[model samples]
Every structure is written in C-alpha cells, then in structure tokens.
Target chain A: MTSQHPTPGDARPGGRTARNTAAVLQATLDELGERGYGAITVDSVAARSGVHKATVYRRWGGVDGLVRAALEHSTERHWEPELTGSLYTDLLRLVETVTSGFTEAPEREVSAAAVAAAFESEEVAEALHRFMSDRHRRAAVIVTEAIARGEAPRGTDAEEVIRSAIAPVYYRLLISREPVTADDLRRAASITAAAAAAGTFTGTPGPPTP
Target chain B: MTSQHPTPGDARPGGRTARNTAAVLQATLDELGERGYGAITVDSVAARSGVHKATVYRRWGGVDGLVRAALEHSTERHWEPELTGSLYTDLLRLVETVTSGFTEAPEREVSAAAVAAAFESEEVAEALHRFMSDRHRRAAVIVTEAIARGEAPRGTDAEEVIRSAIAPVYYRLLISREPVTADDLRRAASITAAAAAAGTFTGTPGPPTP
Candidate 1:
C-alpha cells in the first residue's frame, strides 16, 4: 500500500526533506480523520503541516497519492506474539493491545475516506483488501502455531477465531454507541481462550504423549 | 432505521398513493447512489418516477426529507432468527443472511449511508442507531434463548455473545473488502457456537445420580 522506504528522487538539497514528508503525511491523516475524504485537499495538508505546496505536489503528485500514503503509513505495526507459553496468554495480550486503542479517538475521517474509497475506487480498494488479507493470514499463522502446540484444534478457523476476539470492541465503538470497556475485552478474551482450550481439552492433548 | 408503516397522514390526495410513493422513493435512491448526495435533486426524482414535482413535495416536503423518508420507510427488513432448537443453526442462519446481503446491489450504499448518516445528520444518526441496535438485540435474544436451552452458559452476556456471532462478517465487509461467503459465515457460527456450547457443556451431565 505504501513504500517501505521513502519515495526515491524527492530528496531536497537539505536533510530536512524526509522529516517534512512524514510530517505532511501525518497532518493529512489528522485532517482526514477530522474532515473525511470529500473535504480533504493537498493545500490543506500542506498548510496544516507547514510544508510548501510545491513540496507536496512535486513529491506526491496529488491528493490521491498523498491520501494513500498517509492512510497506509498511519497504520501502526501490530505486535508480534510473545509466546507466553500458552495460546490463551498470547491472544489475551493481543486483545489487551487492541482494546486500549478503542479510546484513543477514532480516526473517523480517514476511516470514512478509506471506506468511501473502497466503494468508489478499485485501486484504493485493492490495496486495502491486500492489507487486510495479509493481516488475516498473519493471525492464522499464530493460531495454527497454537493448534500445533496442542492448545487448539486443527479444525478451528483461525480467521474466525481472531475476528470473534476483536468484533465486540469494534461493534461498540462504531455502531452500538457504547464504550469498549476493559471488562468487555476480558470477557471476549476469556470466551475465545475457553473455546480454543476446549478444542484441545476434549481431544488429544499432545503428540501421542510420548 | 426504518418504519414498519409508511409515514401516516403524509400521503397526498392521489388515486394510487402507495404505488406512487414506492416509485418516487426508488427513483430517489437510484439517483443518490449513482449521482451522489449533492447531485441528487427533487426534480430528478419526480422526473424519473414519472410523477410531478408537486406530488413528491406534497408527500416528502423536499429532497432532504425525501432521502430521510426513503431510508426510514425502506422495504428491507432485518434478519429473523430461525430457532431449529440448535443455537448454532440459528446463529448460522443470521450470519448467512447478513453475509449474503453484501453481495446484493444495495449493500454498499446502504452501509455507507448508515455510517455516513451517523456523522452527517443527528436525526439520521438516531434512526440508524435504532435500526442497528434493534438488529443486534434480536441476536442477543437468540443467545439468551440458547442459554435457557443449555446451549450456552446460563448468564452469558447476551449482547457480547451476539456481537461475537456477527463480527467476522462485518470486518470482512467493511475492512477486508471480501465477500462474506457461506464458508465465512459457517466458520463464524462454528467458533462462537463452540465457545457458547463449552460454557454450558460442563461434565455434570444434568444430575449426578440423583
């Protein structure tokens, strides 16, 4: 969805160019979440970030390019599984990190734009689709590792498992007009853990118990 | 959010009032989804519906009111639970209905408007919230019934249970940009069902040699 490294060929004569790019993209997100797709403009982003208009345009080309960069770059890296010796512990940690984010103020405008983009633009939608599918695959690998360790069943759908773990928090945040409480997080984690555990608890516990 | 009955006392003095209202509203939705909110106009709906502008105004008051009324007086209805004496079956049915809806034509616009309306207008937001909450509660009732039937824990947080049952499809629809296929629906139902069943499936087996 974005360049892992900064875009090539846009370095300024001074060393401040990279810093300027990151800052401008950041303001783009801030404004995006505040104003939505229709309201966002390259000029506003440049003004907000205190970058020159030529810098924004010469480097990013236009609003779509800048928006994609901002949205894709705004995504924080997910935590790696800490392998707390139990699948339940690992996933609970994941759940905790996620629940903490619900209160951090919704990036509603950026979110709104991305969603609108998904409906209105196939290019943006494809990038978003790829990003999400990669995430699903990553979670599946972790859950599959748990299954191998005799923590869950091979039949458990890791995608479904991960989704159930996080669904309530989002529903509350986006639709239900409720807060994502710690209690809710703990409850969801508990249920997911219990189900994952039961998968092995009812079946063979390990590799032949040698 | 929608009304079961058409707006009472708002009908025009026309011979075929019901037919006229449906045609007009359908035309309005078509224009809105295709041409967008700003481009849509009362004149267009009247023209498209083959009715006069006076007729549309007499019923809906104007364009904004007409848009609101269309969403409010929608022909679509929420999912109904099919209690096959199996909580899994009931939940699976619900997920399948919701998942399948995304593939149909109206899902994108419906979802966008519901979400956008929450931010666009307070009145629309209130109606959208009621519509969402009612659908959620319907699922919660099913979870509660499952508990009573010993398919889930006696006092499961029915709302949480409901969210878990439906969350995966939503993520798939909103974020993942994938069609929530039947496989996706089944997997969600299976994971939640397993958890719900585990909470109820204690080893006691009803009564201990009573």
Candidate 2:
C-alpha cells in the first residue's frame, strides 16, 4: 500500500536516511504496542528512535502518517503460509499462524493496536485494510495449491476459503474474547476443507471428492 | 456482567436516580460513537447528558468506568435471532443482524466503539466479553432447534456452530475491511449448515442428516 523507498523528492534512499526511517517506524510500533495509538506523539517517537523530532515531523508528517508507514513497512516483511500436503493440515497451519500473531507478544500488541487504532483514524483503517488484504491474498495460495492437487474443485474462491478457516479464530480472540482451543482450530480447518472439497466455494458444485 | 440496578449504598433505583443513570450512560455512548474512547471524558458526558459534572465523576468515576457501564447498559437490550425454520436461513438472519449493527446508524457507532474500547481497557474488554457471550448463547438456539428437528445431530456444540456461521461476516467487515455481499452471507450460512448436518460440530459423527 506504501512504497518502502522514500517518497519522491522527500529524501534519498539508504544510509543515514534509511536507518533513521527504519528506527522511527520501529519506535512508532513500539509506542503503539506499549502505550497504544492514543499515547503516540512525534516527540516520543523521536526520543525513542534517536532520530531528531524535526526529522520525524518533516518526513512522516505526524502520528497518523507514522502509523500508516509502520503498517506498510511491516507488510513488506517476509511472511508465507506453510503449505502442508493436504488442504486441511495446510489450513490448520494457516490458522495456527494467525493465532500466534495475536496470542504471542511483540506482534500481539501491534496487531491488536492496529485494529483498535482503525476505529479512531481513517488513515489507520485504510492501512489495516491493505495489510489484511495482503495477508488474505498470500494465504489464498494454499487453496490454490489444493485445487491443483485436486483436493478442491477448480475456480474455488481461494481467498474466501482462507477467510473461512481463520475468521473463527479472530472472532474468538478479538470479538468473543474466548480462548481458542486446539479443537476449535481443528474444527475450523476441517469445516473449510470439507466445504471446499464439496465445491461449496466454487459456487458450482462438481462431484464431491470421494 | 454488571448489575442493572444501583450499586449498594450508591442511590435508589427508581425515578430521578434511574433517569440520571440512563442519561449519563447514553451520553457516554454518544461521546464514544462521536469522538471515540480517547476523546471521551466526564465533562463531555456531563455536558451531553445535562447531568452535573460532579455527579458524573461521583457516579462513573472516570472515562473507563463510563465506557464499561455503557457497554453493560447496552447488553441489557432485548435481542433474539430470527428463527427461519432452517439452520441456513437462521444463520443468514443472524449474520445480517451482525452486519447491520456495524453498518446502520444509532447502533453502529456504539457497536464498533465497544469492540474498539475492549482493546484498550480491561474493564471494557470484560464487559464486551459478557455482551458477546450473551449474544452467542442466544443465537445458538437456532442450532438447538435444528438438532431437535433432526436437521443436525444431537450433542452438537451449538455455540461453536453459531461462531462458525457468523465469524466470516465479521472478518470481512472488521478485519479484512471487505464489503460483504449477499453471496458472502449465503456462502457462510451454507457452509456452516452443511458442516452441522455432516456432524462436524458434534466431534462424533452418528450419521449424516438424510
């Protein structure tokens, strides 16, 4: 959603500018995770990043811009679903990855903080939309691979299947505020996998897999 | 999770006291919806409610107390899922209701705000947990009705079934930031209903629904 490189005419790429940008964005995320979006400020980010306050304001604009950039920067980080041999196990892996992102720390605070920040700011919301959409598309590769393996019928809505397998986990952790058991994860994976095999996702059912 | 009546030794429950409580809580919700959690304050709620600031502080304590109370207040609202005979239609109704709570006016702001507030405050989070749990249990009746009618096998986890049916809708709306179409709703209902009939939710298959 945002370029990793500096905005045109803003600053040159690499060296001191690159180091400063990385430090400032990381500090912004740390602030978000620790104190949440409401407490983040340019001065605090600068102090934490060791980048001058004037440099932060000049480059990132303000807290909103900083958060948006941080989200986009994080999106560019290496992430891929572990493609287990079968669709069910592959989806289980996918959902488990999602659970860890929320349940485990470092990522947990920022993941939740981003979602919470979205409600308060349009800039944050748009950035989150892009971030999540990127994840969905990347994870859809599992379903796509399943189709090639003849586990699911052709023309399946791969992203929809991905959403189905992971949504329950999110609903439990974030909305319902319930603990997601192993059984819960298994059920989600099994349901989505079975539905896909039955051609429920393709919208035109072929013969069900025997 | 909180009592609807006055706290012990706080005040009487009838007439002016009740009126004041309702006004202050409603004002709190209004402030939450309009300005969000960060912007809400006792003074603003007092001004909005036309109750005195000292009274607001004395009763609600602070913004956290006000938000927690408002969430608890909203949970007491009368809500029941539309039972449309079949599990699929029933779930469709449930998800549609969930979508509208985020999309429509009056309730939309409060609904999103409450979920957002839960991330920031433990008090609000617990209140949201209770609120959503109540909704989950109430909506599970559709699955219970299905079991009784032999549409699904006995011993199905009715609440888990409800979670599967509605989770995707929420994922699309809040997490992925996608626009939910009628097709998305239908697909969710169908997948969940089929899974239930297949004995996926029961953890032990007796026989598939004929």
Candidate 2 positional error at A179, Å:
1.4
Q: What class would a CAPRI assessor give candidate 2's docking?
A: acceptable
The sequence of per-residue lDDT tens digits that candidate 2 reaches over residues B1-210 is: 256555534456664678789999999999999888878889999999999999889988999999988888878988889998888788888888888888899888888888888888998899989988988888989999989999899989999899998899888887877898888888888889889888899874221222
| Clash total of candidate 2 | 0
Model 1's CAPRI class is: acceptable
Candidate 1, residue B105: Cα displacement in angstroms equals 3.4
Residue B98 lDDT, candidate 1, scale 0-100: 72
DockQ per candidate, 2 decimals: 0.28, 0.42
**lDDT comparing candidate 2 with the true structure:** 0.87
